[model samples]
Target: MILPNSGLMIPWLQSKLDTARYVTAGDLGGEMVADSRKAAVLIPLVLHSSGSTVLFTERAAHLSTHAGQVSFPGGAYEVQDLDLVATALRETHEEVGISPARIKVMGCLAEYFTFSRFRVTPVVGVLQPGFELVPDSNEVADVFELPLDVVLDSRRFERKMVERNGQRGFTYFLEYDGRVVWGATAGMLLMLAKSLE
Candidate 1:
């Protein structure tokens, strides 16, 4: 396992990603829907003096879908975006005011299929210190950071039985402070953690 030191984490993560056999839809017990919409999310790792932390956003309460849920900064692929990477960067900037210039993208995780029928690609990146956030109030309710160590440690996750659409199964979640991270966001985090192992 990679140590949580800021100095060691970046390169160690890159190496792990380099050799990673990325997950696929089938591996997650689902297949991509024929009409699935493409989306991207930025998994931004911020370098703090204490250690590294991951940035996340709470969606605005008024949103029609996934309202008030913890999520990465991202959205559906735009016609103007050159690719999914650009889509992730563009959405991050629009949602949290983290300019694309401030993010140094390391790699991408597998495409995560949401029950909402969006195939979301997770783009991993690192941000150096000194970046300021100017979150747009319309789409973002709050912005927060969780320590990288807490996120990467597989043992930190909590699994509970949940019934969705009348089917009972396990759902994974992570809690920090008073906030909960679950759903597709938590699934992607688990994927990253497993990849590192």
Candidate 2:
């Protein structure tokens, strides 16, 4: 059976996470670094009659980091926030005009480390149908959606290795609309797909 389109229904997506293993293990066998910055990202799912769709934004080219890249709506965590979930929601509102009230947060996915030293938690949320989206022109270049089915299909996900700092590392990439979804954002989605499966 296919996964539900609404974010409200994702808990039924199943829990593939091995909580014991994740919690007991440290750093997934990588060296723990002190510079790890805590961040959060919003993985907004829009349920449609056709299928559930995942939303993404193209960052403005002028941004200092990850400019013109496709990314979820999120940013670094702030001390004033209650938790990572709030950071995700606030960032989504600032970047895409998506009100926190309109989102039904399912839960958070496992944290993924970025090459830039950020440890980001992905907050999964469902957007009610008929909500309007207003992209922030200064930060977001464009907003787009991809069918959830397309993203969940294992055949479409590919792994490629590239050399960094003289060491070969692996990365995940999802191709759609002539655009590539990769890096930390894609890694989080891959984990979501695994959880759903």
Candidate 3:
């Protein structure tokens, strides 16, 4: 089921972002002090027979930085790309083998800051049903899907405090099985949830 058009969250999110004032890039938290790079990511939502699910990938364990972590299939923007949306769609096809033609891009959500020193623009897209997936072995360890409703449910969201830079900071965490979903990825999802509301 498509969660009824009533609960389709992207419309509400678009409205909020349209009217809200955005802070300058410098004012954003979690920005890297070193060379800050620009990147784009795709939040691919698939509507399946079981339910609507969000697609995520587990990074290969041997890679440097953020290895063995669950993430959306994406990377830094490339010069050849025309725009952020193209970057996202291209990256998603390269990492997960989902054809760009199969996606209907809804719009873009807020930009997210990563601890790894990259400012990422997350493009929201809906995957057409019956599309095939071919995961790239070099970059992705495994591909998995989680019910969208479960993720949107506020009861499943939790916050934890951690000591960073001699001060305690609270971060949102989403638990599934024994795996932890936190950091920038989770933050983006939380922002999407807020927009949905």
**What TM-score, over all chains together, does every model reach?**
0.92, 0.85, 0.82
At residue 156, candidate 3 shows an lDDT of 81
Ten-residue stretch with the least lDDT total in model 2? 20-29
lDDT of 3 by residue, 116-182 (tens): 6677888888875688889889899998888787777666878777554354556677988666776
lDDT of 3 at 28: 34
Higher TM-score: candidate 1 or 2?
A: 1
Model 1 agreement with the true structure over 1-197: per-residue lDDT tens digits = 44557777788889989999897542134467558899999999988878888999999999988899999999999999999999999999999999999999999999988767789999999998899899999999999999877887778788776655444556678987888988778888888887778
Pairs that collide in candidate 2 are none
Best by TM-score: 1
Provide the lowest-lDDT 10-residue window in model 1. Answer: 24-33
191: Cα error in model 2, Å: 0.7
Clash tally for model 3: 0
The runs of at least 3 residues in candidate 3 whose Cα sits more than 4 Å from the true structure, single-residue gaps closed, are 5-34, 162-169
Runs in model 1 lying further than 4 Å from the true structure: 1-4, 25-28, 161-169
Error of 1 at 104 (Å): 0.2
Which model is ahead, 1 or 3, in terms of lDDT? 1
Which structure among the candidates has the greatest lDDT?
Answer: 1
lDDT of 3 at 34: 62
